[model samples]
Structures are given as structure tokens and as C-alpha cells.
Target chain A: MADTSSPPALHFTGHRHLVERLVLSTLTGRPIRVTKIRSSSVTDPGLAPYEVSFLRLLEAVTNGSQIEFSYTGTALAYRPGLITGSAAGHGASIDGVLRHEIPASCTRGVSYFLLPLCLLAPFSKSPVNVLFTGPGVITSATPTGDVSVDTVRTAILPIYEQFGIMNKLEIRTTQRSNPGPGGKGGTGEVQLIFGHQVRLPKTVHLLNPGRVKSIRGVAYATGVSGANNARMIEAARGVLNPFVPDTRIFSENTAAGFVPAPERNNAAAKRKMGVGFGLSLVAETSTGVRFSADVAVPVEGGVPPEDIGRKCAFQLLEAVEKGGCVDVVAAFTALTLMAMGSEDVGRIQIGRDVLGSEDIVQLARDFKTFGLSGWGLRDAGEGSEDIIVSIVGRGVGNVGRKVA
Target chain B: MPSLAPLGKRKRPTEAPKSAPATKPAPGTKAAEPESDGDSDLQAIFKRAFEAKFAPLPFAPAADEGNHESAEEEDEDEDEWTGFDSESESESESVPAPVVVVHSTPSRALEIDKSELKAFLSSKPPTAAKPTPFPSSGPKPTPAEDEDSAANLKNDVALQRLLSESHLLSADRTSGALDPTGKNRHKALDLRLQALGAKGSLFKQEKMPMAHRKGIVRKGAERETKRRKEAKEAGIVLEVAQKAKGKSVGRRERAVDAPAVGRFRGGTLVLNSRDVASIEGPKFKSKGKGKRRR
Candidate 1:
């Protein structure tokens, strides 16, 4: 190897792409420096709490890492250490839960942090586990709805599943959290666990997302009129039923998880918090493609069930229209798995039209960060919109992972 | 710094600038040795670009020996190779033409074209107009010979084409003028006329190598369908039955182009019905008046 003694370093301006940078650095075992994070801002400017928490999680997972930051906190440097399963490097039994759970930072969706875990998990000796804290860790990208557990369950988990590690991985929400402006960050708790001793990840070949068969969803209401959940479901179904006659929308009254919203103490402090309620729906196709859309009650006045329902319905339809085995969000993750697969070439076929987005543009840039083999990525050229990406992996077996 | 500019500027919008080998995922094994320094010229250029953007830091240790060539190449070319060589994987596929799918729905069996026949019927003299219910064949499957032959071909001579008898309308002919409210048969006929008039272009078909184009997929077909399609003798010709007895004027055509429109109701069939004929009754002109040599 060129120089494991001192890794190559990269630099950047802000934390906008911080998560990607750090995750990439950790994976490549390269060092990097970042500068001018929120330097332009007069407010308590620096890396956001989410960015800091992500770094902390990375540090927790790896051993002998070196991290330095400027006193102003605007500039920082990181040298990644070896990524091992057991906190103790050599030999130890690995259990994610028994060790400790990295607290998922707020404002940032845990998927942002969890993604690196999924990428790194299979390679580690021990499975990775984390419990999210901060405000709104267990909520939807939508305003108020079911804990995002299902949304990601269908979207993110599939990445790990494609790697031959189905039972070894678990990402489930223990409690639902509602994101609110009044310091109640939904406080929903979710547990993510990666199993140790996963089977070697193999290349994946997913193609042809067939037509959508039906829509399954959850309409959740918490700390609000329980009827609001029903109303949201009714409204959403009304819009969706016209297009998809077989929609199964169930209502889950989620408010029981938290104490009554009266700021918990003085009954006089009770101001009507527009009940936290929303809908989460996933449209499944005959070809294993899943499209998810969420609509939650906003922080301010509640959205009429009609609007939320219609918007969510249309959003699902739009994602289906994009025509891929994976949606735009899931495309990058699935591509990453293929990027990290077996030693031989791997290919995946996706609807051609979806590749024209900016995500693919960013992905191209990101794909370059990983050193590829044989001039790495290639698209098997044909005259259709469906494409097959081929790559020969620099196989990432769980080489140096140690047990507790 | 990597140029903020897009990777492929000279490409059409549909061909996304994708497949750049960002960071190759770490394989389970060590990177292969660069036996010969004769790597791709494009690779050398981009290596330099990456080095300038992320030069090795001062305190950083030496570049990994395995990739020392890449690191060294970067430092050597830092002063040259300013032009951005996008890491786009395929030169031919980076910028694909916009996807223009033409659903060539084949022509359906005939139905009574009332509106087409109506305008002619109403315009004729009462004596000439025969207000008839469309021929009984109007609602039935066209009794055209080719369809009859197709029916004969099936072991049981099956009828009513299951596949969309409507051939896909090529993108160009789809926009051709056709009455929106008119019958599907008329639209089909209009499309046929457009195709016939625009024949040579469609005849010498060129099968595009989808993989050659950025977004074209070769999933249903094996990989490299484009290579086979491009090098093949003929392009894909959709299997469809010819227009049902299109050449033989059927009863439907007979009804629309009836003798009444051209001939006067009470006049002899031999009488000149041209607009130039003495409709002196209309303009009240002398029948023998010399043609005005304006």
C-alpha cells in the first residue's frame, strides 16, 4: 500500500456535504480537512449539532482516530483509524447492543448517519447499533405521520438486504416521535442493529420495476384529536382510491407514547397544540419497486385531510412514474452496495429516465471518490432507457474485524 | 478545486453526466498492480485534476505504494492538463438524445364513420341523399381478406387481434393534423397516409444502440443489444397485420364517397360537374361566355 503510515488528505469549504465527506474518508481510511464551516454566519456558527454528532458516532466506531479542530471551530481535520467490530481490536465477542448505542443527532434524519453504518457494518467484526436522540429522530420527512421506520424500512434496509445480510440487520422504531417547534423534537426512539459475522456481500442485479400493484400505508395521530388520524386516512384514500382501487390505509393512534402536551406540568399552560397527525404511504409494484410518500400535520395550523391526502397520493404516483426498481432516494444507496460487492463484475438495470437527475450527477462525483478497478464503472450501452451498471469490486471482506 | 461546471457540457440534456468513477469501492482484496504505466490518457488527465483539487497535505504520509503511480502522476501533471476531462465512463453514451418513445398502436377494425359521412349526406340534395343506417358490417369486425387470412392461420381461425392492432404512432406522425373528435379509424388512416408519404425515411430503419445512448437500457434483451442492433442487417420491425383490405374500397368508403357529392341530384351523370361548368344558375353567367383571359 502507498502509505498506510500517513493517509492522503482532502479539504473542503463547509459542512454542506460533510456527512458524505466523513463517511467516504472513513471508508477509504484517508485523512481530510474541512474549513469555513458556517464562518459567514454571525450566530453561534460552526458545525451543526447533527454534523458533530455524526463525527462522534464515527469516532465511536473506529479505533485510534486522530481529530483536530480550530479554536474558532470553523476548521477541522480528521484521520480515520481502523474500523473494527469489537472496541478491543484483537479478539472479542461482538454484540451491538451490549457495547453502547451512538446517540443519533437531531434535525438530521438518522438515515444520513445510518447510511455509513450500513456501508461499514458488513465489514466490521461486530455489528453496529445506535439509538437516535435529539428532536425528531423517529419521525417522517412529512409534517406529522407514522414513525419513519417503515419509510426507511422499505427504502434503506433493502441496501443491506441486497448484501446477503437480511436477518443480521435490524432497524425498527421502539417509539414514535413527533417533530415540533416547541422543543418537542418528537423524541421518538429507534434502534438500528447490524449483525456480526455477515455473509460476504455479493453483487446485485435489480431491473424492471413493474407496475404498481397496491398502496399500503399508516395514518398516525398523536397528541391531537384521534379522529384527525381517521380524517387524514379518509382524505388520502379518497384521492388515492380513484387511481388505485385496492389501497389499505390503516390508522394508528400514536399520541399514547408521550405525556399530555401541557408542557407536562401546569394544567394552565395548556395551549391547543394542533394535534400532531399525518399519513405515510408506500406503493408497492409487482416488480419489488416501492414508492413512499408522507404528509404530516404542519407545526402551525393543521392541513385539511383532503390536501395532505391528495398531495401524498400524487407524490406516490410521481415516484412510480419515475420508473425504477428503486426510487430517487434509494438509487444512490443501492448503487453504493453494488459499488461495495463481490470481486467480480456486478450489474443493475434501472429505468433509464431516472438517471438524468442531479442525484446521478452528485453520484458520479461521489463514485469518483472511491478508487475503482479497471477504470471502474461502465454502462452496458443499448438503445433503451433501462441501463446496466457494471463494476469489478475491490472486494471488502471483513478482514481485520476483531471480536470482543 | 474540481470545476463547478458540469461534467459533460456538449451533450444533449437527456444524457445525464453519470458513471464517473468517483471512489471505487474498496474490493475485498488489494488493488491490482499497475503492471504497465500505459494507463488510459483520460485517467492520467483526471488524476492530475484530483491532485490539484486535493494535493497531498504537508504532514500527510507518503501516498500508498500500490497507488503511488496515481499519486505521482497527479503531482507531475499538476502544472498541465487544465482542461476538465469528465470521468464519464463512456464517450459515446455520456450525452444521449432525449428519449422519444413513439407508441405505434396499429389501426383498429373499422366502425361506421358517421361524422365523415354526415357532412356529405347533409350537403346533398334531398332526392340524392339516402339516409341509411350504416351498412350492417359497420359494427362488425371488418370482413377484409387479410384479417380473414389471419383468422384462417390460427388453428381455430381466431379473430379480433389481441395485440393492439394500433401500430405505435411514430413521434412525427402523431402530431400530424387529424380531427381530435374524429373516429379512431380516420386517425389510423391519416397516420397511414402520413407514413406512406414519409416512407423512405422509415424504410431504411436504423436501430439505435440503446446502450450507446446514455439512458437506453438493454435489460429485456441481453447486454450489448446496441452492438447487435447496430451491426444487424435490419432494424426491429414490429409484427402487425396490414391495413384490413385497405386497397379494396369497402362499403364504408363507398358510403362516404358516394356519387351524390359530385353529381347534381336531377342532372345526368355525364353532365360536367366541375366548378368551371356552367352553374350559370349560381353566378348567372352566360354558358358560352369566353373563358376570361385575366
Candidate 2:
């Protein structure tokens, strides 16, 4: 067992940073990027330009160091100048024109100028490339004068692709009304344009190496206690069954310890401390197997061996031992009968100071169905230590044959 | 022996046993003389009684005539009867005196004499006991005998007048000498007079003049009129004043601008235009035709 007596001081050195990065990467499945850094003081050597003050404070605390800090420095601000400004202006104008036009159309007739303004609002004040395919008379009126449609398309296509918004932009034109005091009439020609922009912020992504920290097993005589081993194995199986039913359990003996069933039972003379057994239960999904084992004697106080190795061996043996069976009837029947008649198995206590007589009687009757009988005992020691009986059973095999 | 001699001698001169002392009244010579005098006295008493029964008329007539003749004669006679002068027999001669007949029927005379004696006993000299003088009159009636006598006389006269007037009036009505309408008019007049008298007495006792009473009635009427005028004015003025005052007070209160103590007066806090513009970003501009700049 690992020493878990006192919490050790956490190291916030390079190793600690590596561990943190590893944990974060494993949890999020992505490289953690640091966008900016802020520091409280210029004199602190550990303070980096890109390190946040809170992270610095945490590192200081973990390193068991004192830091006298004052106000934090201002964070670096990113502004993309005319691109952001134009984009914001375009969005506002588009939203405003849409909001104004939709309601005005519903309330009155579609104004000729409003629709044209709504169409052109996204392109206004920004140098946006546009394509045109119209009557010769209409195409000749371009502001740049004499630009072909293919040239315009080529110019704007790369920009749209770079922003990853090529599918969102549409170039079209329609005739609609604009309503205001200066509106000329109900119809006018206007162009519609749409686009997006990409922003590369000041940030960096980093990755760290990873490795397994620990591996554990399900077994008795492994310092997990026989009962705890059984409970853990049961809980695991219980969880697996919802996703995969038709699971079964088996056991074998091995020098390593008790190996799961259908595996070659290997034993060495010097290492044979005692007879050993294992139980393996496979989920119906065949995706995994859960197993538990008990070794009568153990050479070391740890889990015997990995069930994965035994499972591989069991798969090979399963071919040769086709329909070869072990009789778990006696073991199962004994377990069932013991579960029925063994008083200790299901014995329940009507706890002292329980109020209703009827509840006590019902509890007693319920225990009786398990063939358990109980009498009140004073100073019975700790309730969980009181084991009144033990059960034993022979193994069983597939094809309903005994193998003991 | 001595006894025989005395018996013969005494028989001669013992005055015949004193002759039984004229037991029959000397039998003749007018044993009836005293009886006659008694009869004369009885006659005289009868005559005096008859004269007394008739004397008051002549006495009063003579007094009236004597008054016509002279106060001196009457005074003289009064003085004689009054016994003021013991020596004045001439005064009695000048007047016809009361007759006094003397006769011998002593019983009847005795009765008269008894009456005379009673009179004489009763009649002391007026000088000896003078009558009380009349009480002097003052603002208030005197409680003396004269006042009593006068009151009695007045009461008698009033009773007589009341009886006589009531009888005359009733008789006049019954006789039909006056017409029925006249009688009724008189009756009404009388009743009115009675009512007026009653009213007059009531007014006098209360010490109020008619004009003063009239003044009081007029003053009460004026007071009622003034009260109605004041009430009407007050009703109109109160409503208008209250309304005007209320409006003025309301205007003043609104104009003062100082927050009232209990009313919710602090205006709500609203974000200024710059703050809102900064927070929400710039407002979207419209692309309508721009206003012509001046």
C-alpha cells in the first residue's frame, strides 16, 4: 500500500507544470493555449509576460514561496483596426436595415429605397469585391469601370476562403422600396453583398509528454480483503450488465495466483503457497471481462496478475475445450441453498430503538424467507465483524458439466 | 186659777187674732187702681212699640228737612241726642220729641222699663266714648275701620252695578228692541273690549309698551332675514373659495419643487447617453437621404 499518511507539499516546478499540462490535455483532449500574461510586479523573475497573475499566485503557493504582490499590470489589448471597424459597422447597418425594412413592409408597402439600402449596407465603407452578371447596360455602370465578372470573383474568392465563410457570402441584387421623406419612388435597383472576416489572436498552443500513473486489479489476498474483492467484482459486473448482459463467471489455479477460468492452470513448486482460484465474468457485449480471485496463500501482498493475460490464454483454451464443462451446479446450488438456509447470509437486525412493533415483525418475517434466524445480542462487537457462518462450493463448466 | 182669768181677758183684745191681716185688699176703692196703672203702662208700651216700628222713615225725613232748614238745627238736635249738653231741653222742644206714655200696667211697663233700662245701660254719653276718627288716607289704603267700611261699601256698589248692568243688557236683548245683528255686533264689541282689556292688563303688568313689543317683533324679522342672507352668501363663498384656494395651493405646491416629505419624489436613476452608447456599442446608422445642411 502506498503511504497516504500526510499530504506532501506540491511542487510547482517544471515537473509540476508538466503534470498539470498532461492532466489538462488528457481531460480536454486538446493542447491548452495561453493567450496572454499579466504580472503584478516587474522585479519578479518567475513572472512571465504571458503568465496570468492568478496562475503565478498558484505556482507561488504550490512552491511554498511567499510573494508580496500589488496591482496587476494591464492586459494586452488586440484591435484589428479597419477590418474590425468596418465589420462592426457593416453588421450594425445590416441589422438596422433589416429591422427597419421588415416592419415597414408589413405596416406599409415595400419602400423602393429601403430594400436597396438594406442590400448595400453590408458592403458600404469597405472595399469588398463584387461579381456581376447583368444586362450590358447594367454591367457598364460599375464604379471601378470596365471590370469583368471573373476578375471580381477571383479577387474576393480567396478572402472568403481564408475566413472559412465562403459558403455564407452571396452576391445578388434586387429592386425594392425605401421609405423616407426623400424616397424617390417604390422601385430602385440595388446590390446585395455578404461576407465574413478571420481574426488571428495573440495566443500559443503547447503539448507535453504523457504516461500511465498506476494500474490496479480485482483480487482477494491482495490487501483488498476477501469481502471487498468480491464486492468490487460484483459492482463492476453490475455496471457492465446494463450495457452487456449474458455475462458468466469462472475460476482456475495458477502459480502467479488464481487465474480466470479456461486459462491453462500453471503452477510452480516453489511458488505454490496454496491452492488458488479465480472467477471471470464476460459481458454480453464481449467488449470486456471482469474477474475476481482468491489465493489461499500469497507470496506477496498485492494483486496476483493481470486478467488480460489470463483472458488471452482462456480464448486459446476455449477452442480445445469445446463443450468441456465444470460442474458449478453444486457450487451454485450450495450458494443458493446457503443463501436460503445459512442464517448468517441474510441475517438482519431489527436495530435497537426502532419504533414500530409491526415494522420489526415484518423485518423478521422477511429474514425468515432467507432461512435466517436471529436473536438479540448485547455487545455483539462491531456489527460488520460478526460473521456467523461460511460457505464453500465446487466449480462448474459450460455445457452443464462439473469440473471440480 | 190664773189661766181661767187670762183666757177671758185676752179674748177681748188679741186683735181678733190679728184679723188675718186684710187678706182681700181692703175689698173696694180700687183695689184695681194699681191694675189700671199697669194697664196704662201696657198701653203706653204698645204705643211706643208701634211708633218705633214706624220711626226710621220720619226720623230720616225729618233729618233731611232739618238739613234743608239749617245745619245749626240739625247740629243742635244731634247734640241733644248725643247727650253733649245736659242742660239743653230747649233743643229737644224745638224738635218733635219722642213720646213717652206712663200708665199703671206694670208688667207691660216693666218690659218697656227693662228695655229702657237696657238702653240706658247701653247708652253711655258719647263724650265718654268717642267713635274712632276716620283713618288718614295715603298711597296705600289704611287697614283701619274706615277703610274697611269704605271697601265694604265699594264692594256692595260694584256688586250692585254688575247685577244691574248685566240685567239691563240681558233685558235689552230679550226685548228685541235692538236688532239681532246689532246685538251680535254689541256682543262681539264687548268680547273685543274684554280681550283688549285682558291684553292691556297683561302688557301693563309686564311693564312693556306696545311700540317696544312691535320693535322686538320687527327686530326678530330682520334678524331672520339677515341670517338667511348671510347663510346664502356663506354657502356660495365657501364653495368658490375652497375651489379657488385648492387650485392655488395645488399650483403653489407643484411650483415649489421641493420634495414632499412622504411622497415618492426621488426621480429614478437612468443611464446617461454616453454610458449607454459605450456599453451597448454605437447605434446603427440609417442610410436614408441625409437632411439638407443649412
Task: Tell me the DockQ of each model, to 2 decimals.
Answer: 0.00, 0.00
Candidate 2 DockQ, CA atoms: 0.00
* TM-scores of the candidates in the order shown: 0.51, 0.11
lDDT of 1 by residue, A230-297 (tens): 66666666666666765766666655244334455676453322246667788876655677777665
Best by lDDT: 1
Q: After superposition, how far is residue A404 of candidate 1 from its true place, in Å?
A: 11
Model 1 complex DockQ against the native: 0.00
Report i-RMS for every model.
Answer: 31.0, 89.7
Q: Compared with the true structure, what per-residue lDDT tens digits does model 2 show for residues A1-404?
A: 01234223222222112222322221112222222223333564332321232233122111121223224322221111111112223432433221111211111122111112212222223323222111111111111121211112222222223212333343332321112111111121223243332221111110110111111121222212344334333433343333333222211111222211232554432221112222222111111111111112111223333332233224222311221111111111112222222123222211232212343344333333322333333322353222122322111101101110
Q: Model 1, which residues run further than 4 Å from truth?
A: A1-4, A85-105, A134-138, A142-147, A182-184, A196-199, A256-275, A351-354, A373-386, A401-404, B1-294
TM-score, candidate 1, first chain: 0.82
Off by over 4 Å in 2: A1-151, A162-165, A175-192, A201-404, B1-294
Largest TM-score belongs to which candidate? 1
True contacts kept of each: 0.00, 0.00
TM-score of 2: 0.11
